[model samples]
Target: MIDFDYLKREIKKEKVTSFLVYQKGNSIFEYYKNNKQLEKLHKINSCTKSVLSILVGIALEKKYLTSIHLPVYSFFTELFKEQMDSRKLDITIYHLLTMTDGLDFPEFGEWNSFAPMVYHPNIMKFVLERPILHPVGTHMNYNSGCSHILSAILQKVTNMKTEEFANKYLFKPLGIHEFYWYEDKMKINKGADGLVLKATDMIKIGQLILQQGVYANKRIVSEDWIKTSTAPYFKTYDSIGFYGMHWWVNKLDEKNDFNYENTYYFALGFGGQYIVILPKEEMVIVITSEIYENSLLPLKIIQKNILI
Candidate 1:
């Protein structure tokens, strides 16, 4: 069992802002820095990516799309007919999900201000024009642009915007109230990121995945889809780290670590928002923080308290 008292003490000691944990759909622990319930409508940053991944899975299950192996350009051929090179045509949805698109773009650059001068003119055109540095499926490069491209594909294939499709099929059914998705100038939700939801809603998302895409007896997503999304596909910047779809997979040794084989996967966001799903322990951990510099602190605390 997790030591709630010590966990709370450490959170307070380490200046954690808000933390909550749910095991098998039950609230097991909670703490707030200022003794406040984090608004259920706060921006959750890139946790939105995981949500988008779920949507893609749903799209696949519905047969609206074929498979991740299909080349991305195959779906958006008309948009890039003139500029689509053989290298670009080689890119696939699986590459996008695994962040192996090989397209050139800063994964963490200052795009907010630079959007006016560069991206606003023609985002897709600019993205396709970038140099491919590696063969698809051979490298793991974090690219927000790749995710946005997937989102655009989702819109084109589904004949509905990502936000609308998710709202109707995923969010509404899961009771994810009060959320917003930022859009590009072309009015496409930056499905690669740019979603804001409450901390509890984040937990709900984790829970939904933990339950294998089931919600309150309703099959919102398929078990097969969940398995594929959570399965490790590529390693990120860190050596031990790997990514599965849009989710980050943390590998821990069971013999050396208490929660070994537990396989704690999570949806991570910038500025310290996380929805962690510990399947073996039947636990879901939700954390929100303003300490962008110390975002890993919350994960470290949870690892120490529950998985050590």
Candidate 2:
């Protein structure tokens, strides 16, 4: 068994609310503090993007999305009120998924200053108006606007909202019945943030990824999609190492397939929400916190204790 007493002390020292661990198909450890409920439906923040990653996989398999290679603006041609940049047309769904859209969005984090683009009547338009700062596929920038456009793409292709399509396809199959994905005024679900799910359900997401996109013996998404999504497609400039579709990958050490590597690929949120999957260790860790700033504390815990 793991040491929850020490972890509880660390969690008490911080504003962390929930911590759950699953290994070998069992929930081996769990902890809560700050009067956090076991079934609390708190927003996972940008961790929501990773969920959208899974939905993209499902959409691909179901043919809701024609191809990640398709140009992003192709789906929303009717919404543009002004002439658009030719550079923007070069962006593809893969660029959005990988956050290489090169959109010069000043907005970084929610805690950052809100500009006109955010509060504008239409978010998709706001996102599109941002100047292309770099050549598409040549730079890596973390922008939520790309995620929102992706959500909009889901709506355009599926003719259903992001959350609705996810519920019908991704969430429902995994027995995730209780969850809420907040939307903007235009009824477009915030794809980059605003998904509220219980800690258990969040772990189920990690579990699904750990299980190769299968849940309860059912193939919710293809195993090939899981591999493709988690593969190290691009290496970020930061220490996060490589980025896969939307998943962060750490292929630092590998010996054999099952028992050799200590690598863990995870979904990270703005605050501290995480769904860390260690394929070698056979472990999945989910953490939710209120500490929006310096969210590295969770990663510290995972590194110093869990992964060690």
Candidate 3:
């Protein structure tokens, strides 16, 4: 059972804008400081990468792309030249999905830098032109530039804008209609950030994953994709836990006060937005917050109040 009173107190303390708990096919609890904010769109920062991962799965199911193993250069042939570093040609869709493209793009550690690519006029070129600092697919570097490259690849293969494809295959099917997706100057949806969705919509996304890519008896994406995408492929930052395709996986071995062990995966965004899927508990926890400096605060609150 969840301690709602304690949860509310903690949430209020953290200044979380919205909080939701869905379990066993029902939203067991919901809290919004301002009820009107329930339907308001909130920026879901890096969670956009998880959504793009879904779109990529759909594209694969539809045969728009043959395989994730396919070299990214095949899709973005125009971006490459004969004189370019041949190693860049080795980067695959899998590399981008896993954030191991190793393009010398740093977004974490003392090298907390993303403004260069974000502000560049030709963002795709800016990302691709970066020096390959590590061997492709061997090291996991937290890089949003790699996520943006995946968006560009999706657009190139689908022959439609990433947003259009998402609307057709993902959003509309999941009953998500009111939302906003920001695109780069090249018109590719920002796969790393800039997706605005309501807290309820965020819950829907979590539910979709919780239900193994099914929603309302409809198979929105393959179960294989769900398992594959959420499977932990690498250990990320201490706070972020393990990294999957574009998702974050965590396992809490030590039982909480209730003596319940927990293993879950989540879609995390900058500024405290999260869509946490707990398959064992059959629950989905959605949180959107304004705490920009401490994006993990919501997760900590959830752990203290619910997971414990």
Candidate 4:
């Protein structure tokens, strides 16, 4: 029961580059005003973290890493000096996934903010050298550093680049072959931002989550990880409901694009990139825009016009 006219109007009003709605394994609506945009790959900002989250699941499934609770420092012992904060020793993969790693990461933590190391010769030092800003697991700081550390862990454990791992375990299986990742000077996947994907590939991830780690009749990711990643494990400092792994979640506002009393969790990025999944409705919404805005406008359109 999508209001197509309403959707078109809103996309025009907001100048959204792409809007895709998928339900029950089908794309019900897709709109792009310009032909060039339709063919161009869009940058999905922080949503890269969520995609890494999926890779973690795949890594865990294949036993590249033992458990999420394992201490991250153990995997990268060379990164740490002989003397460091004892509390830092407590940091774990769970903390990284939840953005609770407690490094004093500021907004835009990845661009050029790291201390003495900078992103020049070694990006890993830039991330690993960060001082512990908060206690482990007490609060959420919305960190890209944490995700990068997880990426480092994946690479160290699997002995393969994160993109290679993803290509094997995630993208190839999902039938996604075309994409590029933002790499640091060290050629490591940024694992936080600068992932370019086609609109269809973006929604493919949404559909994968909606199907609980299954795609094309094959198990792509672990169901246990998917369920645990989507469950509201901890509340965010912002008004955004709970954050599970790298996903933002909130309760169903029945008045919104969802008529049923169900919850929705989405992978959001800067400048209005989103992959929102309304689990109860079997609906997956992909929105890409150039607004440099927050989450309100696209959310409103989905709530107001496309819920039922």
Model number with the top lDDT: 3
Better of 1 and 4 by TM-score: 4
Show model 4 residue runs off by greater than 4 Å: 108-121, 254-261
- Model 4: per-residue lDDT, tens digit, 143-245? 7778778887888899999999998989999888899987777777878885899888998999999999999999999889998888777775445567889
List the candidates ranked by TM-score, beginning with the highest. Answer: 3, 2, 4, 1
Which of 2 and 4 is the better model by lDDT?
Answer: 2
What TM-score does each of the candidates earn?
A: 0.89, 0.92, 0.95, 0.90
Worst 10 residues of 1 by lDDT: 109-118
Write candidate 2's Cα lDDT for 67-138 as tens digits.
899988688876543636788888999999888888886554352623354577888887888888999998
Candidate 4 lDDT (Cα, 0 to 1):
0.81
Name the runs in model 3 displaced over 4 angstroms: 111-113, 254-262
lDDT of 3 by residue, 1-308 (tens): 78798788888887688999999879888889798787789999998889988988999999998999999888778887732789999999999999988788767865553446888887888888989899899889888888888888888888988888988999999899998989988888888997889889988899999888999999999999998998888886877788999999887663332112456889998888999988878899999888888888898887777765
Model-by-model lDDT, in order? Answer: 0.78, 0.82, 0.86, 0.81
